[model samples]
Target: MEGKKKIVIGLLGESGSGKDTVAEYLREKHGAKLMRFADPLKEILHIFFDKISREDQQWLALQLRERFGRDIFPKALKRRIENESGIIVVNGIRFWEDYDFIEGFDPGYVIYVTADQKVRWERSSKRGEKSDDGADFKRFQELEQSETEVHIPEIGEKAGFIIRNEKDLNFLLEETDRIMNEIANK
Candidate 1:
């Protein structure tokens, strides 16, 4: 609300829904700066494990919230956002706190990425960054129920822009371009 002029975008999506991919596309195509809530959590995960998993990430997040407070990440991210300008994309908007902080940006938009559960499961299987990436469908379903992921769909309902990522990369990028173009006209 001060002198800085920034277009903030909050990205909300379930695991494997292509949120990170879209953020990267924005970064490369729109010169958008990216900030993720899980960045700090993932940094901590990297310190302890050779291969980080979604389950562990959820566990760590809950632990931190219990030790500190629910606002820990949101507060830290708010500080980070204040320092950044231009097209800034805040990935992993899971909680109300995340959305509330992002709402302060004058030209902000929430982008929700959605895909069929099966398609997302398939995509998750191919991504080896998480140790449980290749987990079976049953396990994948359980992981989706974790606290960190449970609120995604509800929050996604609040998005002004929605992108379906079930198709090819080109289609996803095309949809992304469409949204960016729409935002530009705003």
Candidate 2:
């Protein structure tokens, strides 16, 4: 596998924009291992609260960044993936520092998955995940103004590949496969 390039793909997008779907696609199709920067925070939160809600996760992440450093999650994720081979898909890249840290690994590709706000809201509502339990248009918009959500648009602008996921699952999978091929060939 000397000629096989090990790709580190950072997925960037708003909530319910299909980032997790794309990560799952990469895992199943390309045998890419899935990693999330919030994992460590989630683990720590689970210790304090039996059930860690999405809001708790976000609050903790912000607090950790403010108290510790902006690069805390990125540093932890880099350490976790340092020895991993083949394709690795990182699902929760929120800050510019996260992007830069992943790119430092070489052969890193950031793919930004996006969809219309209405469509994303619909998808989010239909998914019925605990994170979206009481989510509405106004709440979603409010979340977008948060410290973490504010950075995603800029990250999407700078992503190597941008995929608009407004259509069916097959369409998304096909687009993801095409992007994977393009990255693999690069």
Best by lDDT: 1
- Model 1 C-alpha lDDT per residue in residues 37-127, reported as the tens digit of each score: 8898999989988888889989998898879988778887887788888888989987777877777678779999999999999999998
Give lDDT tens digits, candidate 2, residues 1-186. Answer: 133467789999888899999999888878898999888987898688766556777888999999989999997887678888889889888999988977877888899999998888777778766554458888777777888888898889999899999989998899998998898677
Model 2 clash tally? 0
**What lDDT would each prediction earn against the true structure?**
0.88, 0.84
The TM-score values for the models, in the order shown, are: 0.94, 0.93
Count: clashes, candidate 1: 0
RMSD of each: 2.4, 1.8
Minimal lDDT window, size 10, model 1: 1-10
Give per-candidate clash totals: 0, 0
Off by over 4 Å in 1: 1-4
- Candidate 2, residue 22: Cα displacement in angstroms equals 0.7
Which residue pairs clash in candidate 2? none
